[model samples]
Target: MSDVRTPTALPTTTIGPADEPATVGAIGYGAMSIAGTYGAIADADVTAVLDASIEAGANLIDTANVYGDGRSEQLLGRYLAGRRDDVVLASKVGIVNGGGIGKRGIRGDRAYIHEQIDLSLGRLGTDHLDLYYQHRVDPNIPIEETVGALAELVTAGKIRRIGLSEATGDELRRAHAVHPIAAIQSEWSIVSRDIETYVVPTAAELGVTVVAFSPLSRGLFTDSFGPEDVHLGGTRANFPRFQPEHLGANLELAAHFRSLAHRLGTTSEALAIAWVHDRAEQLGARVVSIPGTRSVAHLHANFEALQLELSDETRAEIDGYAARVSGPRASDPNWVSGGREGLI
Candidate 1:
């Protein structure tokens, strides 16, 4: 029984050079929940959540080919069957799972490329995808080869725009050279601010908008975690970032964020998102936050974060917290994504 807030009038927000309208209502639907990231959810329940997200002013929906072994796209497609045109649907490919072979990696071969798109389309029940991304780099494939193939898809009217995820600045530049990238989706939460080094700058230079995922530090910055909280669950249990031994130090850093967020009269989630939103804008770039959630209530909470602004002091406090965080912010050692990239 998830609570869904009704869509209220969204404040006028500007979009960046290659991005969509900055504010498309509040909150966006994250299809990963439907794929059972933390726990299993009935397909009907996922549909209800999707529709609930729409009712809550969520027009942007995020999903991937790997999510639920492609179930998210299928379910989302089935869920949005009649109203596909009403939403901005985003799906990603790459990360080829070679029939459970350790050969699992990315594939951009023209034949494979076309095949994956067809599969995603069939699953999503859409003629074209609004945004399509390469989920990960195929150490076996060249960026030029991959982006070139994707560019052809755009010309064929199969996709509206192109984006890259978990990519380095060099990787992004290479992709953008082949085609004008619309967005660059990545994990850019307060804890995963590694992108501030080059991804943000490259996006600004290339007229690409940054779509930030995990804007809440994978729930660490929410009201739940504290200096004393340490039990980790899900696959994160194996991650060094969430290891019980390191929990105390990480919690201490999160406290700094909590204090600053409180002073600003906003949730840490709100403060974190606002920092990215405002900073990107100040740099003459547009940014969007797409925090994923299982409950529509959480979605609404994430969306409302955009309404809260951080003053200079609050922003500075957040930077201070970032500096104090212990260990890598992302689920570390599980995978290497082009080095300091992705939702760390």
Candidate 2:
């Protein structure tokens, strides 16, 4: 493990139980990349990133069972051995990855959810998850049945709060009716604003915190990203936005966004996160951003965005970039919540 370089603590935010809420760091750590979602990561680097996140007060660690086929959770389990209580642990179920192109599916049936929770708990080495999400909505299973299973976990003390990832406004509403949803995790960044059309408004009305994942557009808003980065490995290479035809146009737009960040005396990645925080406030919704990184320096940099304040004008300018992007948010719209908007 590497030593922590910066130890600045992030500000706090509240996530709901409706009956009682829990306070957690405003900026959380998303463990996807550490498990090779972006590319292969060394065990040492993963340890350092996890260590740095907790040291800097970004203790809200989020992961999913499908991430590296549960390798991410196992690594976190090792790290949380003696100090699990010090962190706000969250993980998700659903979305089985078959390890090839177009070989995945979502399952939210009671039996599957029940089986996965135990596996998640065993791998995480924790008896309970602070927040558990339905990684993706299962088209075959009704949202009500899925949420009902999660509600049972809450009763069993396996999960403290319920969350739905990439769920549409209607899906969120239906799930919330079955049981109070503490948060809705989705991709909400400079380029992905479709959620603002309906999901954000619904979450705001229900008083559910919007946990913004990929707030930096999965590195598109960062300095290191480029058209050639697609070959570096992981699933991002297959995303439509990074494909040959759309990459150039998106890169040009990112250049302008990066220039704006440079003028503001901040990294494009940090500025992108600040934009999410600012926009959430403007939309009358509470948000916590979980930006994943394999580097400790990047971890510290991500949490530093908590102190950033963006002006109304600047936020709108950043918001404008969303319109010019060239591809759909996902290769298959059906894979994300926006695609399943009207369906159950």
Candidate 3:
């Protein structure tokens, strides 16, 4: 039987582009999980998650154009028909997923940027996105040119705010100079701390909110699934950290963390997310964590994390254990573009 807990009210946080400010629940929903990335997810299940999120007071709904070929946004659009005003809608572009196999590419050109935003708006069934992000940094184009095009969209009201996903500190600075970068999306968790060295500091210094995706480290931190559950047909099977050789070591570390959580009388998943909240507080930076899950029960569990408060001593212990985690966050170095990786 699945372990289910009582739902708790989640607190709200503010994250917006440059001068614009918008408030959303502390824990946002990452819609990609229901787009069949890991496996087939029924539309009913997707709706349930969305409905549960709204009921739980989670108003930040994030999706991307590449997710299931834009099906993710369409699902949200359908669920958000009358309730659009209740949530902060966010989506991304720049990663082109159409054309023949292998035709996929990242584009930041002015024409491509202009074209994608309209298509995304159509899919999302919204006139203007609360926040729009570049799914990946297009190395071929200059950051200034990309941001310039994005700025045009902001002026035209196609998107209220601009965000960058997987952007390096230098790239973020350049993009911000072109136009105020409202937020930067990157993969950050106890097991994945690569962004802390530079991206976190830079975003903090610039007063840009860091939207930390995959705050549960793609489910490893939750202890709900083990290495044996990762099969060839699954999305996580392609991840290096979930591979046979690395899985054992990673699970061992997770087990240790889970034990610590048990001692604190909370679930591992809650503790893992609370660690992220704690880290953001320590940095004095605005951060929003979007942990994806297709199950309503899991969604409830995730929100419960917002109610947890970790002591300095416990935080240090978790950090020390995380330092010993095995394997790279991403198996493919090419996927680690713009200094962000482990994104789902």
lDDT of each: 0.69, 0.86, 0.82
Residue 313 Cα positional deviation in candidate 2, in Å, after optimal superposition: 2.8
- The runs of at least 3 residues in candidate 2 whose Cα sits more than 4 Å from the true structure, single-residue gaps closed, are 1-9, 342-344
Q: State each candidate's clash count.
A: 1, 0, 1
Q: Write the per-residue lDDT of candidate 2 for residues 16-91, one digit (tens) a residue.
A: 8767787888889998887888878898988788888887778789999988889999999998999998899999
Off by over 4 Å in 1: 1-8, 11-27, 97-104, 225-233, 329-344
TM-score per model over all chains? 0.84, 0.94, 0.91
| Backbone clashes in model 2, listed as residue pairs | none
Of the two candidates 1 and 2, the one with more favorable lDDT, higher being better, is 2
Output the lDDT of residue 272, model 3.
Answer: 87
Error of 1 at 244 (Å): 2.8
Best by TM-score: 2
Error of 2 at 249 (Å): 1.0
RMSD (Cα, Å) for all candidates, in order, is 5.1, 4.3, 4.0
